[model samples]
Target: MLQGVAVWAQTDPGPQRIARFEAVEGSIQFQSAADNQTRLADPRWPLAAGDRVWAAAGSRGELNAGGAIVRVGDGADITFTALDERNAQIRLTAGTLGVVLRDIPPGDRFEIDTPNLAVVLDRPGRWRLDVDPQRNTTRVTAEQGSGTLYGEGGQPLAFNAPQSREYAFRSLAGSQPLALNSGDAFDRWSNERDRALAQSPSLRYASADIPGVAQLDAYGDWGNDPRYGAIWYPRSVAADWAPYRNGHWEFIPPWGWTWVDDAPWGFAPFHYGRWEQAGNRWGWIPGPPQRRQPYAPALPFGGARPNIPQGVPPGFRPPMQHPMAPQRIGAPIEPLADQVRRDQWERTQRAQQDQHQADMQRQQQMREAQQRFQPSYGQRQLDEQRRQIEQQQQQQMFQQRHQQEQLMRQDQQQQMQRMAEQQARQRQIQQDQMQRQPMQPAMQPQMPQRMQPQAQPQVQPQAAPQAPMMRQGGVQNRGGGEPGGRGSHGGPPPNH
Candidate 1:
């Protein structure tokens, strides 16, 4: 993962890296840092410190912490104790987890705390940890890298690749290290997922270090522009689809209002890149590659506002504008703030117009009532209007119900027609089989009587009757047989 020193202006605590739910399956539940109530997990929501995730039975969850991938298996529980550019700490309470570390920068820490021991990953590799609460044991298996295990007493036990050990809760006193056992179904699943991520074609255009970039390959196409370089265009979007429109806003701490997109490939493009409108299609520009790209909560229209970090050297200009200013091509780009103001003004005007019309109607009704000196007349008019409205509503409801019934009848007719056709085809197949059965015996060659022994005298008697049957069978076969025949042999049984 790329490590950056730039901090978001809205976030006060420093430059905090945000992790996201890359993949979610079945009943995955999560609790945010600021809330205790658990909710069904959404892949669009970012993961941060103090957040808890639970993969219920028959469920699986995957998280991308920077470049490292953490997969949670069924019945697993985990919490993000700390997550930022410099450190990623996870706490596992029960079940299984698989971690694939792509890179670990210097001075940065990646640790997993189990019930019994703290497993620190010091190198880039794959590791699996399983916790059995009933046994009060935590098993750590280093599939490819080395790490140190710390017990409750702070005793350190160094383990290298291809090693596994089960330690008692809070103690490593007499634990024996063993060879790593063969992985089970969870391990195979994790390996397949890792391979897919590694082979993503979007990685060539977007950085692999950016979480959720792998998901783009299936949902979009990557293209290049002379001006903006590589760009990604999403497939099967609405004609009016725009960035930040299909998603909702949530006030997440540190980042303030954040965008949670409904698309599976929405995270990386919305948070790390800028959008450009070309003709009627929108393309995402991931900007130039940086060793450590900064994370943005939302990239609003007309390019993202500069998120100037604190403690910068002199003369530092943030990359706020896209490669081409006025991000839209072939059209004028409107600033988001100005657009919001215009929409608000239009709404206010509409409201005022509606209110003025209502007042005019009220005054007209009052004047008629006063002129006639019959206040009950106004009430009668109101009642008549209400009755008209009720009649119209009832008419519309009747029309809708009639339409639904027509549709149901049409569907039933089509289904009956299909069944009739299918049955006809089945009968044709059975008739064809019956027609072919009698021809098989007649097609066989008739041997001379001298070729049979004298003990087969019954065959001769049966042969006389078969001769007539063969002639009848041949006549039938001739009707369906080929045009030409071998010496009147009934066209070789119709070349079946």
Candidate 2:
């Protein structure tokens, strides 16, 4: 009992962190980090240290913080002892929880303490913890990777896919191993879920390193916009769907209003980038994933908050059912800083905002310069177009001249034939008149005038006609139109 107090005293809480509520189902209630009151659980609820979540009968809950996913089964209670970037500590008082640590950096910690012993996962793996305080026993089954069960005397029993008994910490001098767990329906379900997420086409376009991208793939499909690069649209949402809707506003200590979304895949999109209206729908612009994310949505706009169930009432505190039980059942239980201080999240946030504003200014300047350059571009296009029209007119003139010359030649030929026919007829008539009657007035006969025609000039059409390139926005070049690509994710919330 004195040990708890000593550990709590020596510990220095550095900063606050957020764990993701990946999924929530059935009857479950969790205490909020912002308001310290037990409220109903939602998929996108952000949990932190000092929070506790209880799962009622036939209930299930899942918390995903970075690479670790801790799932609570029915009739279970878990407390967050230390939930931060470097360590993730939880105490399972009763019931069972399935844990899957996808990745854990070296020197990082993930521990699940039970009444009998403390289970520490030193590597990436899947494990299950079941505690029975009535029997004063705990059992840890390592399904994959490696872990260790530390006794009260500081003895470590290595686990490489083994099932082990949870003995009383100081009493058990030796530890034994058992068979590797074959997994259950939940394990199969997880495998299928991951496989589906891996195959998501959005994964290819987006940075796989982004934590909440898999959720995006599940909720939306990838599409490309001519103005923006690759984007994604939610499958089922209001036509005027906007981010920060269907959520509540809770005041994060030292930080202003923080939005908690109810959707399962809400964290990354809200914390990292900006939102652009891509026609009828909205798309999140994650920017370059190779940078730090902010605390609030990178870009905040004023919008109405969604109507949601109110948090736990004021002055509401859970009953203390078991006073002797530890929040975490582990050796040398480390304490978390309960005091609120300057938040590091908001610090990064301000820096990111400054950078974002600078970038916007630069972009505006570029756009202004482009606009100034457009007049000359349009002038050049107009000159080239006029030249094309003049050439076409010249070609038409030459073709018309040639056609007229050809028609004149044909008319002259027809006239000459008619003249010859008339002359022949006249000669024949004169002979007939002389034969029929006495010859008279021979002096009057004179030579007929010779027919003549005028000459004309011929012309040829222009051989080649060229057209210049006509661009709408001057020399601006854009991404090539491609059909398939994984969409990018992340962005700030819309107006409240």
Candidate 3:
């Protein structure tokens, strides 16, 4: 063992070896230049110019010139052709690698050119390049500092600002820039973080600390702590589906059972769509979050969000602002109550109007049916019914007219009787007034002096023409003259 620590090397179609090796803190392994021999180490090793390396489980190493680090993960192969105190250039034979620099030396720039993309790192920052051999697409992420990416003809793409992401060299010959996602961020961070952890090697925490451990510690887990970024939840099946190792997770539509991982396109759904429960199964639909979906009385048909059991809490839901949160089922939707009430009222009114229209339509249909059948064998029965209905209508009209006429006659007779009785009462009041006094005193004011003149001839004016003789019973007595008691013919008649 070298330095009392186990050291191993294999050169079977792998990177060439370098002589005069030095190990640093069991973290960084370094070797001096050896002519025509390739030297490689685990991701924990450091590399320099003129060194060729191959990554078995995606190893990332550093270059001493300005402490710049480059990582290659999972079946990747890279070679440094011009690495030195001033020059940094590498070639990627296959797979993905990310480049980050501790400091960029003045007049010392690094260039990475692939079949589809070319990146020139002029500043200190983190950047990634992914080459899909079959698809021929190059994905890039520039986390900090700015860089210029080029197409085949050095056509410039402005890749400035931190976290500015893009994908180049697509399957199609002429393609637009593609944006980066959280999953890509996760992958990039994961790789670099892993490289850092491998370099240092002694840190631990708990499951809660797993996220923190991944955040804080650069070294890998020493005590096999679950909290060291070494866990993944199944998302579909909660029954402990953590990857004891590293892999990928893919979303399949219709039945969103996340059944596949460890592939190029598998991680896209979680990064670009929504998760929902449909048909009692989980699924992912592609869209933005629906912040105003109505609260459905029942879940939507087909792929719908199934209710989680009380005992099982689903994974934490992402905020609406986050782009990757699923839209259909997991979308953060909240409809206003007024909007809901308005919709319900509109539906109710529509139903009511429809029912009324239907009743009218049914009546029309029945009439049409009767008319249509009248020309057939059922004509006799229909005619009989129609005749009976006509007769009943005629009878009802006649009764109404008769009642109106009777009411009019009774009202006229009562009016006549009232007029006669009123006239009789007026005549009786006049008779009573006449019997009380006569107007003779007003006609003779000098009569009182004549009566007092004693011895004077007792002359009296004739009594007022007897008022029209009062009639008795049904007839009036004829002969009733004044003072002489004689009728105009000079003969007295019966005076009852």
Candidate achieving the largest TM-score: 1
Ranked by TM-score, the better of candidates 2 and 3 is 2
Ordered by lDDT, highest first, the candidates read 1, 2, 3
1-496 in candidate 2: lDDT tens per residue?
Answer: 2111111112333233456666666888988665677788765545678788889987776776656777887688998898766788998898878888877777789898877778789888878877777776666777678987777777687766755455543444544554445365555555655576568676565544345666787787777666445666667888767665566554444333445566766666665444456665666655443332323422321123212335623443211112212322221111123211223455678899999999999999999998877667688899999999999999999999999999999999999999998678658755743454333365655334233241111111123211221223232111222211222111122111
* Model 3 worst lDDT run, 10 consecutive residues: 1-10
Q: Cα RMSD (Å) per model?
A: 30.7, 35.5, 24.9
- What TM-score number comes out for model 1? 0.57
Better of 1 and 2 by TM-score: 1
lDDT of 3 by residue, 344-445 (tens): 787799999999999999999999998877676587789889999999999999999999999999999999999998689659855864574345454454
Stretches of candidate 2 exceeding 4 Å from the true structure: 1-16, 162-164, 168-179, 182-212, 223-230, 235-248, 252-255, 260-267, 276-281, 287-496
Candidate 1: C-alpha lDDT: 0.69
> lDDT per residue, candidate 1, 222-270, as tens digits?
8887756788899998876656556565556655555667787888887
